[model samples]
Target: MTTPEPDSQVGIVLVSHSDALARETATLAGQFAGPHARIAAAGGTDDGGCGTSPDKVAAAIEQVDQGIGVLIIPDLGGSVLTARLFERPSAVVVADVPFVEGAIAAAVLAATGAPLPAVLQAADDARTYRKL
Candidate 1:
């Protein structure tokens, strides 16, 4: 079978307690990154389980991790556990940053081929947007 060409867009996953929050966060992140960026999201279901299970997260990473890398943005503490539970290929990177600004900045940077550390640093610096 012929292999599909790798995609250059960044892949993003959002894990949150609220599905709406996750989707909204992904949408806002897309806005920040513009239309060309590739983004995928997952969230917690009504029962409090992260909408994307460990297996599912791996699959999503595989799906999006073409030539570009996949970045995971988790909502809270447990969300980190969920991401950690999955073992992904080298094309995926999980950022230990908060879900809000962290995910957004990472998505934007990933779209531009920024290194994982640089992306994480940018996400960490995103706190500037939290002004009252």
Candidate 2:
């Protein structure tokens, strides 16, 4: 099989209390969305502790940005608050949806070259998704 062409689509960032969780989730989202997806992880404190860091989050956002908007999915607690700090009316958006599900949904939609609004909508829609 041949590789797909890279597209300038919305990026995704996963913020979590544990660095491992965020990194693994980003990997899962990237894998599901294929190699062209832009996903980053901003988890834990800068000192390798259990917490969130604005600096780390900002770096992740920069790492994945491709002139398009980005979607930030925070795990919970302070991570959500930190994620909100980067929210912008056009270039950046924070999705208040389930962490893993939202990341996967956002990444998948973004990989298809969807716009920020569409990617955000898909992530939000994942909140109502039933897995029964």
Candidate 3:
């Protein structure tokens, strides 16, 4: 049996056009995400090309899902479309927020053991970030 905890666990899945960009962004977020942060990058085509693949996304979600829940962030329009195409488990949530910034916020909150809803809220809040 697992130990009972008060905080809700949530992981993040980043879907980007470029594999390197996705991994690099994940690394940047992981810096502040702490050890417990679960961030997965599902990018590029199945044949090692640039694009999002539903297969890759499903696999990424499976890898990151740690029994709590998952938040999906997509980089481009196609990436978002691909994320939407994949049939996810009930616990999956797709947040409409800036990909990089949202991932950073989500990673930080998730690292602190915040609940799934809280994490998604934080990511959604990232849309207000000042780009000026």
Candidate 4:
């Protein structure tokens, strides 16, 4: 099988119950990936609200899923649900990693032209160390 080429415009999106968490994660990921990486984020509102809509997540993924790659880090419940709703292309990866650090790291790796599998593996490594 031919391996897919690495994505150059790789981006990361965090879906969480708090907008701050999402934004913070995006910022942290930017630090790791540097100023040029493409990172985006969205969060669920409080007051017993549904987190960012699945469509919004899908849109974000679509926006970044160019030939490069796109990685999505979801908080919980809604975040995972939103990711699950999409039919991810080979160029896009949706990870259920709940921690910001791990997600950010994964995004950074993806942004640096790492393959999706490698980036996901890094995210999983981060997830293992995160204090859930």
Candidate 5:
């Protein structure tokens, strides 16, 4: 197998209060993104409790950094704060979209080689998605 172009596809980070939650979310989103998009997870505290950590967030961001950008999907306010605590000079967007839907949409767009702003928009647009 061959590798995708490093800068062509944007990356995604799933931040949650549970390590299992983050990994599961990333797995679900990865289905839509295929293997082209980089999807990482940053969840739980150092002791694996209900909390977020800046170090984990930074690691997730760094893991997905491919030169294009990284879109972060935080499960809650605390997760959002942790994700923002270690912001980078590079395009590290903290999207305000719903966790699951946002990750799916963002991953799909990013896999298509969408730019940071476009991927962000895709994630943001998921807010209106409904299952009626």
Candidate 6:
């Protein structure tokens, strides 16, 4: 296995149809993961509408990538489609998991300096996470 870079955690990108939702989800993730995790929100359009933007998503991925890799958690519909456009095996992975929960789990694991695979696993594992 490749050794993780020192102080470099897997980046996380949260994509949603609403800008506020993405921003808020990132904020909530920060609250749980602390301040060091590289997380970004990509939502809505440049004109601030109720849709996802490829430009915004690309920019967010660029903003957070630190060479470790980036995990993208997309809400649904076009957001998922947009995220898929940027998927690169080693550099970026579009997670197939619940958006909010995946973001939280990914952020928490990434913050702990977990490897990209481990962080991705955490996000995937969140699919079955329960509140009860």
Tell me the alpha-carbon RMSD of every candidate.
5.7, 1.1, 4.0, 6.0, 2.3, 4.1
lDDT of each model, Cα atoms only? 0.68, 0.93, 0.84, 0.69, 0.87, 0.92
What is the C-alpha local distance difference test score of candidate 3?
0.84
Give candidate 4's TM-score.
0.77
Better of 2 and 6 by TM-score: 2
**Which has the higher TM-score value, candidate number 3 or candidate number 5?**
5
Top-down TM-score ranking = 2, 6, 5, 3, 4, 1
Per-residue error for 94 in candidate 2, Å, reads 0.5
Best by TM-score: 2
Candidate 4: worst 10 consecutive residues by lDDT?
Answer: 1-10
lDDT tens readout by residue for model 3, 1-132: 532333546889999999988888888888877655789998899898999888889998888777788999899889988887753655788878998999999998887777788898999999999988
Native-to-model Cα distance after best TM-score fit, residue 116 in candidate 2, in Å: 0.2
* After superposition, candidate 2 runs with Cα above 4 Å error: none
Residue 46 Cα positional deviation in candidate 3, in Å, after optimal superposition: 1.2
Model 6 lDDT per residue over 17-75, tens place: 99999999999998888878789999998899999999999999999998989999999
* TM-score of every candidate relative to the true structure: 0.75, 0.95, 0.87, 0.77, 0.90, 0.94
The sequence of per-residue lDDT tens digits that candidate 1 reaches over residues 30-128 is 788777556666676546664545654665566656564567777777767887665355556677676788878877876776655676677777766
Clashing pairs in 2: none
The residue ranges of model 1 lying beyond 4 angstroms of the native Cα positions read 1-7, 46-52, 87-90, 128-132
Instruction: Give the alpha carbon lDDT tens digit for every residue of 11-53 in model 4.
Output: 6777776777777878888776776666777676544365667
Candidate no. 2 TM-score: 0.95
Residues 62-84 of candidate 5 have per-residue lDDT tens digits of 89888888888999879988887
- lDDT string for model 2 (26-87, tens) is 99998989988899999999999999999999999999898789999999999989999999
